[model samples]
Target: MNFPVQQAQGPDRIGQQTAVEQSRAVAEVQAAIYVARQFPRDVGRSRSAMQAACGSMALADKAFYEFPRAGGKVTGSTIHLAKTLAQTWGNIQYGVSEMRRDDEYRQSEMQAWAWDVEANTRHVLTFVVPHAKFVKGKVEALLDLRDIYENNANNGARRLREAIFAVIPDFFIDEAEELCRETLNKGDGKPIEQRVEGAIKVFQQLGINADRLEQKLGRTRDQWSGADIAQLLITHKSLQRREIAVEEAFPQARITGAEITSKNGGGRKQGPPDDDPWAGQPTK
Candidate 1:
C-alpha cells in the first residue's frame, strides 16, 4: 500500500499555538482576579507580616543594592526584597517574561509585570535586554546558553523589582526599608568586631582588601560602624549578583601576587570561602 504525503502547515500551526497561549494567559489572569475578589487580603495582617520579614538581618542585608550613576550612588531594594514583600503582602501575581528574541540584534524583548489581584491594580514594564556583557569597558557577546539566560535573568530582576514596587504602596515600602535599616544596625546578635571581620574576609575573597573597602567608605576599619558594615554587605551582594562590576565597586583595588598571598595565607589561590557569615541566618 502507498502512503499519501501531507502538506506542511508551518505558519498556520504556529498561529494556532500562539492563539492557544494567549487564551491560556487570559484565562489565568481572569481566574486570579476572581479568586482575589472572592478572598481579599487583610491589610493589617499583610503589613504586620511584611514588617516582620523586613526585621530579619539576613534578609535586610541582601534587600538593597547600590550602584554608581552620574557621579552619585543610587540605592534601591532588589528583586529578592520585592519578591519577599509580594509574598508577605499576599494576593499578588508578579513575574518576568521574554516576549520575543531577535538573533540579529542579539537582544530579547521582555516584560515584567505585577498584578495586585485584590485591588485589581497592575503594573507592566516592556523592555529589551542585550545578550552582551561589559568586560574591561568592552561589549562582549554571550555565546553560552547559560550565560545568556543569566544575563536575561539579572536584567529582568531589576525590572521586576520596579514593577512590583509600582504596584505596592510607597508608604509600605518606605516603612519596610526603615525597618530593614534598623535590623541591620542591630548587628544580628554578633559583636561589631566579629561582624566586621567576617565582612572583610568576604570582600577579601572577592579580591578586595580591607584598605580598598575602607577607601571606598572613606573610613578606617576600626572606625567602621554597623551601618558601614551593612553598606559593605549590600555592595558585596551587588557584586555577587553582577549588578555592579568589581572595578566599579572598588575602582582602586588591583589584584597582585602579594594580595593573592594575603588572601590565601601565602598559599595557592583558591575558590570563595566555604564558610559564609550568614550561613545559618534565615533569608526571609
Candidate 2:
C-alpha cells in the first residue's frame, strides 16, 4: 500500500492569496529567529555561528528577492537551510518544511503557526536570545555596510566597513558583556531599543525593512517569562550615550525582548508581524 500525497484545496484563489501572504509574514519572522541563533555576538568563538547567520539572510534574500527575479527557479533549499539552522540553534521552530511543495500559502501558514507556538517557548531559552541578537544585528550591519560600499564607491567608507565586517563575528560575541558594562558606566550610552529602532528605521528608509528579525524578537519575548525588554533599551542607550562602537553594542543586548516587545516594554506592546514573513521552505 502507498500513501497518497496531500494537496491544498483550490476552490478560492482570493483566500489562497491571503493565506499565502500571511504565511510569508510568519516565514519572515522565522528567518529572523534563525539569524539570531546563527550569530551569537556575546560569545568568544562564533565564526561558525556568524557564517550560519549569513546563510539565513542569504536565504531570505533569495526567497523574497532573488527567486522572484530568477523566474521563480532559485529553489527552496535556501529557505529550508534557514529554518533548519534556526531550529538547530535558536530552539524556535515555527513551521519549517524539509519537503518541497507548491502551495506557498501552506508554507506561510505553517510558519505562522510555528511563530505563535515558538513565541511562547521563550522561557525555556531566555539567556540565548541576547547574544544571538547581537550576532544577527552585526550580520545586518555588515550586509548594510557592504551595500553602502558597493553603491557609493567611497574608498574610506569601504575600507572602514570592510575592517568592521572582518572582525565583527568574533569581536562582539567575545566581548559584548564587558563592552556593554563599560559603556553603561559612562552614562552616555544610547539604549538598545533606540539602536534597534534606529537601525530598523534606517533600513526602512533605505527600502529594506527587517520585518522578520523584529518579529522573531517579539515572538521570543512572548514565550519567555524572565525576559526583559528594558535590558535591551538600557544596552542600546549605554552604547549611544558613551559613543560605544557597534562591536560593543551588537553583543550587549539580546534580541529576545527587543525583537518582540515594545521599547523596553515601556509603551504599548506591538501587534503581531503580518507584513511579509518568509522563514523556511522545502526543497523539491
- Give the runs in model 2 whose Cα sits over 4 Å from its true position: 1-188, 191-193, 216-284
Best candidate according to TM-score: 1
lDDT of 1 by residue, 1-284 (tens): 99998988866466768899999999998898889888888989989999889988868988888887876788888888899889988998989999998988899999999989988889999999999998766999988889989888888988999999998998888888998988888778899999989999999899887878887989989999989988898899889877788878888544565556654385855334334576557778
lDDT (Cα atoms) of all candidates against the true structure: 0.86, 0.35
Taking all chains together, each candidate's TM-score versus the true structure is 0.78, 0.17
Question: What TM-score does model 1 achieve against the real structure?
Answer: 0.78
Model 1, runs deviating above 4 Å: 1-27, 253-284
lDDT, candidate 1, at 154: 84
- Please report the candidate that would top lDDT against the real structure: 1
All predictions: root-mean-square deviation over Cα? 10.5, 24.7
Cα displacement (angstroms), candidate 2, residue 31, comes to 54
Flag clash pairs in model 1: none
